[model samples]
Target: MPVAALDDIRAKVGQQVGTSDWIEVTQDRISAFADATEDHQFIHVDPVAAAAAGFGGTIAHGFLNLSLLSRMAADAMLVPDTTRMALNYGLDRVRFIAPVKAGKRVRGHFTLDGVDEKAPGQLLIRQTVTVEIEGEEKPALTAQWLGLIFT
Candidate 1:
């Protein structure tokens, strides 16, 4: 991961920092998530049942979409040049505004919301993120994500 100085990161507050690459939401991937999480709701694992239920086909789980933010951040989030490591501090707010159906592609748009120097060599960064579904006006989810960077 390329790194940026703390001051450099802070300079872009309230501005979009990066956008991640698109990731296809395949049924196989959805099924794997279901198996791993034991969230085998038919709407996520059964295409027929999901279609009958009016979702058109299997829709990925909300959590599944949320979990992808970490992967998305690898490409979209900035890392302070002086940092030794960064941790997922948590999310402030999250909303699932749209369903991501199988075969759809999604990517994250990240904006630097805020940056706080909690202490020397420790920084708390907040980002506003939107997980956009391909060809859709509404995003799959939006969140206020936080990270703790240790320099």
Candidate 2:
């Protein structure tokens, strides 16, 4: 499944492709992220205080949810034979729709928005990502992401 041509890619509009991965938002993971980003917020790292404060448990950092895009995208976007390298171009829109509590499970759903030809052998793809948290009304995160693939 090499990178498709602009015309072929265009034909995929309105199509949705998805992959699900079980991700655990553990306390240790949250704590590590807090330390790495220097964001020692009690709501994210202090389980005891967070529980007492009414959240019932610690929460994951917003960026942690954002950072999972690559892993999720890898599962969703499939470019078989033709593409040699794929690079994260950037993101168009990103929103944290819900909180991801520690010890919860989350998964991602992807929908292809569009793909454009940037130059010869280069294509830019735009995809909408929805990260769902088990038993949650709102998704953990919703984002429009971009990628550049070279053939």
Candidate number with greatest TM-score: 1
Q: How well does each candidate superpose onto the true structure, as a TM-score?
A: 0.97, 0.90
Estimate every model's Cα lDDT from 0 to 1.
0.93, 0.81
Tell me how far candidate 2 lies from the true structure as C-alpha RMSD in angstroms: 2.2
Worst 10 residues of 1 by lDDT: 1-10
Q: Could you report the Cα RMSD, in angstroms, for every candidate shown?
A: 0.9, 2.2
Segments in model 1 whose C-alpha atoms lie over 4 Å from true places: none
CA displacement after TM-score superposition, residue 144 of candidate 2 (Å): 0.4
| lDDT digits (tens) for residues 1-151 of candidate 1 | 4468878888999999999999999999999999999999999998999999999999999999999998898888988888888999999999999999999999999999999988888889999999999999999999999999998
